[model samples]
Target chain A: MTKQDTRPRPKAGPAEPDRPQRRKAAAAYPYAFYLPAGIVYVVIFLIPTVMAFYFSLTRWTLFDSTFVGLENFADFFAEQNLSIGFRNTLVYAVLTSGLKVVLGMLLGVLLTSRLRLRGFLRSVVFFPVLVSTVAVGITFSVLLKPDTGLVDRALALVGVSGHDWLGDATTALLSVALVDVWKGVGLATVIYIAGILSIPPDYYQAVEVDGGTAWHRFRHVTLPLSRPATYSVIILSFIGGLRSFDLIWTMTRGGPGFTSDVIASIIYKQYQAGFYGLSTAGNVMLFLVVSAIVIPLSWFLGRREIA
Target chain B: MRTFRRVTAEVVALVVAGVVFLIPFSFMLLTAVKDSVQAAELDFSWPTSWPIVANIAEVVSARDYVLLRAYLNTTVLTVGSVAITVVFAAMAAFVLQRRAGRIGALANFLVLSGLIIPPAIVPTIWLLQALGLFKTMPGLILVEVAFGLSFAVLLFRAFIAGIPRELDEAAMIDGCTGLSLFFRVIFPLLRPVTITVILTMSVTVFNDFVNPLYFLPGDENATVQVTLYNFQSQYSTEWNLLFMDIVLITIPPLLAFVFFNRKIVAGMTAGAVKG
Candidate 1:
């Protein structure tokens, strides 16, 4: 009986239908579906990236070129403001991302709670995300002007005198970083809200059953579980802050004699100065700095996520 | 009593956040209608007389109606880029999800890296020059689509995983093949993700500054953000007109967000969380 069953199963498996149709469809589709996007990505993104590496080694204007090995990199590093730009970039990125994480999580928790006018409030917070960054920079620059700006005037009402917000060397970078946080925290909050919502209710219920108060529940459940969102918020904002140019360019233009120059603005200044090779090197360096920080951070978070 | 305290606390928090967020925008709007004198004062005092229509007209007519031209150019750029990104990303996503192989895995890595790595602008300009697309509208369009494709493809791939393979097989059994099968059967089912991509990408491309600054430099090809340069010069103090320009350029995307607020939030968060 066993031998007869095995013989019949082999025949049925060999003669099973639909395999030919599936194979035909597979053959027809091939991998050409990836062609359109693949072509665009390769031409516009991938090739430029590969060329960036090569071009950074060559001293080239728009119409001329000469190979200069690592001289551009040396010159980029040796520039008078390079060290300040590097330092400012780190400070700006850290300040913005750190504030964004804390503020975003706070707002997210509040908005996700049983609050009044939650939807309207969320919209209000997120409205800035839609505004153009350049516009935001300009508006804030106007508002934050030393004395005549609305911000200072409003401060005067409360008996606090306003100083140069974006003009003074001391406050320029920090001021821009604060605006960055304001414009970006909305996104961070949205992400955190999504993360908080995704947490299963059972965890909270379990905490309650164990006599955990709201604080305790949040401390033990929400905070730990929202790790993924926090990771993303930090990485996204950090990268954004590192690559920040438009706001700085529009707001300060590395004002007060190069006090607020981040790496990107520095690169743009080089490009404006016709140091194409040096700017390309700066771009590569910025790329390296971002990836070096973000990749490992992501890996660490990912491993923790699985664990 | 505890519940009352909690409620009051929540209300306080909400109001504070609302004020912080809304004040900048409200001030922008207020200044938009103010006269040049009132704008120079830069105080919170309400405009004594609203000249909103006049301000709009002036901004519209400034520099040979450059703002209107910018609006047209931006609309073209946004629509064209979003359309290309959606179609190409959807097709690529469908194949990447359905067809698992070595090449697909490499493609996946490339897409992911595109999200992390910064675009090298100088070389990109060079390549565009080589292709005779530098300083051209079509070049800028291609740049937008390329930069946006990674996020769209990632979102589509996540959404597509929930769709069972049996649907493809079932469609194929009914004589649907290749483009017909995708367009007829599968594409219709991807409407939610499609809307998400469209709305999100449209807002992003429309609001983008750097790409247009680098790739499309001519005044004739100015996007809305680029037109900010018109109002702002090295030593000009046209705060009123500049604020008016801000209000005008901001209206379309701002209105889009207000109307589709829920979908935009959902779509944006969905991409981030899933990614």
Candidate 2:
């Protein structure tokens, strides 16, 4: 409702004498159009983010605060699980993003090829992406239960023994990361498919004309051309890996002694323990870590993308 | 031989993919119908007795019909948030795409930050409490909209960039000023992207567990996902009832995917592919 064209528009664009001022006032793109979204975003998102910075420096309940800077940050870093949480976050991000990049491109290539039941196969791979994470976590948890679970049972028939996937600390983080990939690789595949499909036929034909085999065509053509898709997948899934809480919460609760805990879960557990100040600090740390990785990566990716 | 090999590879891929993805769903469906003790085994075996109807009745009727309330709450949350997300995101994206200057660049930065930054939860809860929206549906709805806006804005911007500026010029020349021009002309043309936003945002909000859990706590106000989480604990040993709840809550997305599969896939892929 606060949307009215009152402010003077910024002076830019071509200096055409034929341009009319009234045309600039077109409703199709009003400064007021940004108002509704801007207000909600500022109030609900941006303001709180700023407030989180202040509150992270304070030791207060929802009601009152005592400004206790640096102490909360120190405690958060000093916590035993902090290192594991940070390390696991990196491992999970790298593992999921790395695997998805490779597997998704392969599936993208396969699905796009002259193949039977490709549609069904694509849907089958993508279906898990839409399902509830908690449901998938619970299902996989049961399916991975040491010996009786289907995964172990299935492995037994092949005369290979299965370890306690989620029960052991070594495998807990790895198992959850694999499930994250399973739930996500569909998306990466689709993105890669789109990227791969967008490449003109000339590129592949050129490769073939060079006496190149299918491997040469794929290795040379498909992979490099899909840089944008790879960037998209890496950032999306990697950030997801960094901030993931729900699946980890549902599956392990960061258990096996918090071996599988990530930054987001650590924040949640801190909050659950009523460590409001510490939790806020944890969130700030998480934001920094994510921005640290993503900002530079985006800069690097964008630099390459433009040239 | 080449054709045979291609077909053979396709068949093999389908089989492997089918088993990997489809088995979990089958297990969820099968386990939901079994009796408690039998369900606890968590094997892939079928139920000895089909108590699906009875199981559905119990899960629905459990916790003083909280699941029913949760379904209603979730429906309202999804509709309210997705509706706002579509309209607001489209409007903002329209402006940002058309007049992308300094302010637009700043706004874009904020939007991108929303995607990567893990929201500070305790502070969010504190702020919501100050606004008297804490543990309330409207508050949670706003939270969802806030979180959803970035992706929605990006998607709409990509789609709107494709809409010709000539339409705007023509509309403005006809005495359609400000909101009127957008409402009459540009907005109508945004149908494809709008549907994409609606379906994808609907799924995101409906399946959202964390926000509702953090912001809208309490029994009566529980979202369907929160109910699923709650049921997981109370029915920790009662796998049948627990999975029954999972199946119930999972139906909405399943239905959405089945019906609007193309739009959902397009919306998700559009941003990644094009951008």
Candidate 3:
């Protein structure tokens, strides 16, 4: 009986098997089914991305073209605003991402607490995210207008005059950055909501039973558990801030003598000025800068996940 | 004593946060119904009279009814782009995840590249022209679809991971082929996430300004956001109509949230919450 049971079943052989055939059949659907999407992925995305690299090396407009290797890239770095654009992109990315994470965590805690009118409060906080960037920019521009705007009138009520929020070169970028934060922090908040909500009740209960203070509970249990959400908030918000354009454009059009010009707006300005090749090079640089920063950062974050 | 102190602190914190976010929006609504001088003054006081109807009418009838056309264009663009993006992305993600090999890795990377890289506008322009789609609605639709596909794919892949593999096997045993199997079996299971993707993508495409500004530059192709320029002239700004324009463009998405804010947040964080 033991010898008979140890013998290989005839049904398990390559031709005679149910399991092997099913496994092979499972494998077949992948390639055959994935083919159409794969073809589209190549034609629409891959081909164009490769072509962009090539075009950055050429001088061209809507209809004109000529090969000019490295000249476009050279011109891009030499522009007066190029360095400023790079500096502003990094600065905005850091400021916006840093602030959003801190605020999001704070709000996440507050809203998730047994607070009053939680539903209404959450909607109010997330309200800015729904409005169009163009509309938001325009509304803020009017509201923050130095003399006639509400900000100034309110300041006047306090015996202080409002400063030129969007007019002065110094304040323009800062103003835009603030609005970006306002429009965006909802995303971080929502992420934090999910993260915090998922924490098992027993963890909190255990902390409380151990005579944990609110601070102690937050420090050990809430903070550690929400690391993934925090990481995501930092990465997504930072990347978004790096590529910000619409709000900046609608607010000031990178004006006040180009003080507010981000890389995207600078590229658009170059395009407007008929320097197509240079603009293309700027696009390439923007792509490289974001990729270089984000890929490494994601890898760093991913390592934290595994550990 | 500690509990009392904590409650006081919480109340103060909540009020401060609420005021900081609320005041700007309050001013916006206030200005929307004010006359030009009053609007420019930025007073937070109630309107001297109700100009809501009058101001909105002016905005609607501005630039030879341009805002109406923009509304139509944006509706078409948003509906078209979201429809294409959700279907294509869902299908691609399903295939990519089901298959595990070089092609899968390459597709995943290609999609990932979109997340980090800014679009190469010049090349995209050229590509559209090369395909004879430049300055066309179809061109804009394709552009939106290409850019949007990656995020949609990411969302779909993450959500699909939660579904059990046994369903696929059970369906295959019932004699369903490729499209039928996906549409009949897999697709229905994906409805919750698909709704989320649809809502988020619709909001994104509808709110998009730059893509429409560049790719669809002509007056006939103007989206509602682009129509803000109708009040903006090189010579002088029309403050009243412009403010009204801003208010008008804001209504749809604002209304969307009024109805579906909770669902949107839930949908948005579905994967993040799980992972």
Candidate 4:
């Protein structure tokens, strides 16, 4: 414990003002308080990030490495699955984030409205968010097994046959995206509900005074005011979808010939195959992609938020 | 008549959302209590006889009680990480809020970047290996705290801004200095946000899968999420046991969420909504 001496020293110089001395003393206190967290964060997180940049440029193993410059990046880029992985990553992010925003807003509005059992319904929707993603992935994989599974059984009752949801290349990524939305939409809805409820009733009353219909009130007041929540949902879900791995790994393992693979999963695959340096590069690229999108989008959203 | 129609419409919407959200969980529950023969069918039919106790017994005791070990390991990891995260984040956030300087601004940026950027896993593994902490519980605990620190710090900073600086001065005037002033005067005032951080961070760490998988790889260090991998194999067909495993692993956190539902939701959305 590096305890700072807190005893006030006798003033030696009369020219030094008390306020400046106090400010200096207060400044030193913050650094002391911040030291534990700063040291842990920098050592564990920041250093590894810097090390990743260096390691990404080397052909490394557990023991030794040779400088490979941009070869690892080139190899990662030239891999046959890279294009599909990139496309799938974008598609998955857009699909999940879009659906989460739309569905979450609708549900948020409904739950905040005069709905029966709204509390219970909110709990039910949020229950899955607490469950382990791997558990959800496993449970959904079994349910959507296409044959003799509960989902298919329910579909069959409607005279519809079910396909192998997780097995089919065409529907694999889409199906997983839907599950991602399912497991996640609860948080989005909660955020939207908070956002919507925070909008003063005066806004709605103004529309009502104008003889606005429900649609008009919603479109004119609720939708625009809830932009912050919508922005958050899009950013959170989109970044989550881009970096998604656990559920995909548990559910499909990026199977059906890399049709459903994202960049993160691809990176994991490289690591699993002992391509540590290549995977480190992949990780860096994933970070760059996420930062590239999120930072600018946040700035754009922040600007609009203020305006 | 109009009121009746509106109520009916709301009812229909609630039922639809409820069914969609809960069907998968109900399926998991139904499958977990059935015999192997029935579980293999994987339909929504009621089990002829409930074997929940038997299934739980077998799952808990399987393979040298590995699931039980996983439960213990996960509990330790969650508690350890949450304690560290809350304390460190609170201390840092307290300072960052009270003192705005260049270092504070840089710290804020680093914290925000942690939220936005995906962690580079391979290099982290190498670093951990170099420190002789790889594949160890402490290593995984440190990783969890590092990852969760950013969010906790952000939440606390938001909450701490509301606390006045006069309290600090008042405490200092009473001869309560650095650590004592924080512990005696400041930390107790941060009760609401502290609970929020504790519950949220605990849940996050408890439910985390990737960090545990990558950092702590061996069976001895298996967390609850890693135990799911043990339940599934390339050709295994024991759906009943598997579902039972899922149920057991899910119960603790699920109950925590249900009990602290409001706090968790408030804590999670606090930053997004307010900031």
Candidate 5:
């Protein structure tokens, strides 16, 4: 670790002993530092967000757009698979986020044990996260291909019939959710590692001194201290699930009759089908849906942080 | 003894965990090597003959070598996007962290919101069209930079915060100009975090499927992930070729993680842990 000298930077102006104007300006230096990022945020993100709402009311292709006044949204709702996509998005978000946090923490604790080859194990666990989403989806697409997949072969070893995981409407969404959990659990583990490491070992020692069991220590000390990590995992994973496209697109393309079509995939399908106005509406709905969930959650989390 | 039991339990747990993680990668590797029949069977067995060369040839030669073209496009996109993101983000973060006020607070919130909100794609397309940047590499590059800058700025802001303001002042005292103050005085000290930003940004831009799929449409500008469509038709998907495509696409980011995983983790966790 590099040792940092914590000296404050010397001011530019001559030894003018603490003028309010200079102090104000100097104190505002940080904002000056932040300006370029501010421009980027406004232009790229905020502008787009504001325009999405505006355009969602309009019927438009790439170049020419006209004010249609919520007709697009109505069309989106009126569409056959839209409702299903909406339901799938919510369910996928909840399941993937819930599983990721639980599995991530468990895996994190297991990996952090006083085991051999700890570094190697950590790397292994995190490897999936580094793979491209499309690649993971493609790999699993083959691996879960009912008849010839490795998973089916493994099932056959136990005298069980294997079914098409991605092609089956019943299993497709859940299968994607599981693969998401598999890929993303590493991130949650990373968070947990940082969280766990930060907790003073003395807490564990004190618990032990009090005749507390391992489970007891974990329940009272480890879990509470790791709340921040849990919160992070939930929020990040939920948002990811809501916006997930690549994996689902590659695997089944929301196939077997739109069984696994999350909102994002539905929107992409609209784009693919050349329903430009409808797809744009779907995009708006996705933004709105994510915002509706995330904002309140962020506020609640922020309040919790304050508490 | 209790100690012996604890150690044994820990070892067993570790081995089980390792197997869970390792098996998938093993599956990927074996699938890449196996012939069509072996692949379809999902046989965990060793390949009778290494079809690695043949598979690579097929994937590369598919769709007029679009996958190879996609790889080149990805490289260009990643490099261009990262360079823009790092430079612009560092500059932005420098100012934001240095200057403090209501404006700063508002700017900070906007950037944070960028981190949370899913981008509205349709409007973005319209905006691009209005700007006449649609279906262009530079347009996609700009879009990538725009999205990427928020996270980079956040990282850079936190890292820059730790650097005392004294250095900026001292440099100013020595008659350094605006650009010099940043380039010569402050920028050099940002090596660790800059490397983190670069590594993370590069991986993200390279692995990105959506942005390129949307912004850089057409075979001429198609990126690696989008090019995987070559293996898929209306009816059937070429599993062997698709897996090979997977191998190719997965390699760069995997290698990146192998080298810079620590930095990437540290960078990501910096704000949360430190706060």
Candidate 6:
């Protein structure tokens, strides 16, 4: 009459009669399997990250060094473009991620709405994600020219004037961020599309039963249910915007006087100027900035999942 | 289900996509064929005469065929890093999922950090110089693999979790040893996820611009993206040639998307869509 009598017998091959036999079986999946990847990841990614902190305090060429304490950090903060880079990084991340969330959700809803050309539209949107960022950046730089570019020409046809988009400090960062949205919003859209498609139909049916219109369905069902997708889009795009380099580099070169200079671009400029310690310091600052913004943001977004 | 709204949405999406996506590519094609003067204008106009062949020659021959060399270098970097990533990530993922311990948890954190944390580029270059790997293709390839590993490992780990534990036991009972158990039995079952990892990693490593720009400097190791960037200043006013370079370098990714469209979407959206 014991509870053990109700249990089914375990299969012979996997069922262990002794602890020793189970241990032996576990040996088949060795811990050594982690070594190869661990070696490469540590040597190439993690070690350098640890070394960045040490090297940032030293005025050294790659080969030789003399410790300079906090000079590099002070110089980095005082650098003419550093503040702009910091401001631009946050602005770029916010602007890009915001646009991506709104636009991606809308497009996601559109694509999942049982449209005729869903497949075609999805392909068209996501294809840009595969294109070269440098190529796209350059193309947009050309397109954003004041008078002769296609963007301005089209705007003129619509009775709107086009300004010097990339040449002006005021518009340069905004312009680059917009182009980024164009290239990247595809990724966000796909994520959103997947999230929307995975939603259970029962909720929508419940809305219908309650005489919910499309707007009501979206507001009540889709909006609340798609929080996971929204979270993913914001985090991924925000991080991407923070680390952004090639697009800004190719488009503006942090130019028109560093208005569009992001942290990554700032680091590159320091390195290019032979300020090795300063560049390494900039790298540390970027890491800190990314962590400060992202860690809290992700925690805030993720806390609701537990409930 | 609503045909009217669907059609309207479809038309609007089409127009927006056409203008945003289509016109720029069309401009690239058009500009690539135009004479230098018209190309420099950077306007949307039919070429008075299609100097497509000359443009191609000038672009391909520019800087003593640097673009062709870039294509070769990019292929090596992409293929090399992607292959290493698939094997290493799959192996590591296999262990990470099967073994539940502090080691596994720590490893998982590091892998995840690789995704969130930006690389310290200057320190990395210094380390590479110290190790005699700077300005070398192998160095850059390893860098790419390191960066690509985290995502691949996570994807493979997720996929691996779905694979039953019984498979490992069955194989082990058949006298399969440690590595062989993973390679012969577990690895083959990973084809679907493997393909996904391969496609996405290839696209990422191939289209990468900054890594090669920073790590693998010098014309000897110019990647496709670097070649395009270099062509920018070199051919500043040569719009036809510049666009030609852009067109040339864009093909591999374009071809990949065209053929493996579904797989790419599934692989990319796999993480974001899942809770």
> What TM-score would every model get versus the actual structure?
0.94, 0.95, 0.92, 0.95, 0.91, 0.95
Query: What's the lDDT for residue B82 in model 6?
Result: 94
Worst 10 residues of 5 chain B by lDDT: B230-239
Instruction: Kindly indicate the candidate among 3 and 6 with the higher lDDT.
Output: 6
lDDT of 3 by residue, A1-307 (tens): 1243456655544544464554655543545555544555555566766777878899988587799999887766676676688788888889899989999998888788877666777777888887888878877887778887767776888999778899999989988998898888888888998899889999999999999999988999999999889888888887899889999998898878888888899888988898777787878888888988888988898788779
Docking class of 4: medium
For each candidate, what is the lDDT? 0.86, 0.86, 0.80, 0.86, 0.79, 0.89
Candidate 6 lDDT by residue in tens digits, A101-192:
99999989988987788888888888889999999998998999898888899899999988899999899999999999999989999999
**Per-residue accuracy of model 4 over A1-307 as CA lDDT, tens digit each:** 4576678988768765566556645743547898888887888898989888989999889689889899988986787785577778889899999999999999899889887688988888877888899899898888888867777788888999878988999999998999999999999999999999999999899998999989998999999999999888888887898899998888898888898998889888889899999888888888888888888888898899999
How does model 1 fare in lDDT? 0.86
Supply candidate 2's per-residue lDDT for A96: 89
lDDT of 1 at A271: 86
Which scores higher on TM-score, 2 or 3? 2
Better of 1 and 5 by DockQ: 1
lDDT (Cα, tens digit) per residue for candidate 2, span B5-123: 88789778878887788888899999999998899898889799889889999999998999888889998999999998888988898889987667889989988888888888998
Give the per-residue lDDT digits (tens) of candidate 6, residues B54-81: 8888888878888889999999999999
Better of 1 and 4 by DockQ: 1
Best by DockQ: 6
What iRMS does model 3 reach?
Answer: 2.3
Candidate 5 lDDT by residue in tens digits, A151-204? 787789899998988888899989888888888888888888898888899999
| TM-score (C-alpha) between model 5 and the true structure | 0.91
lDDT score for residue B222 of model 6:
96
The count of residue-pair clashes in candidate 6 stands at 0
Error of 5 at A101 (Å): 0.9
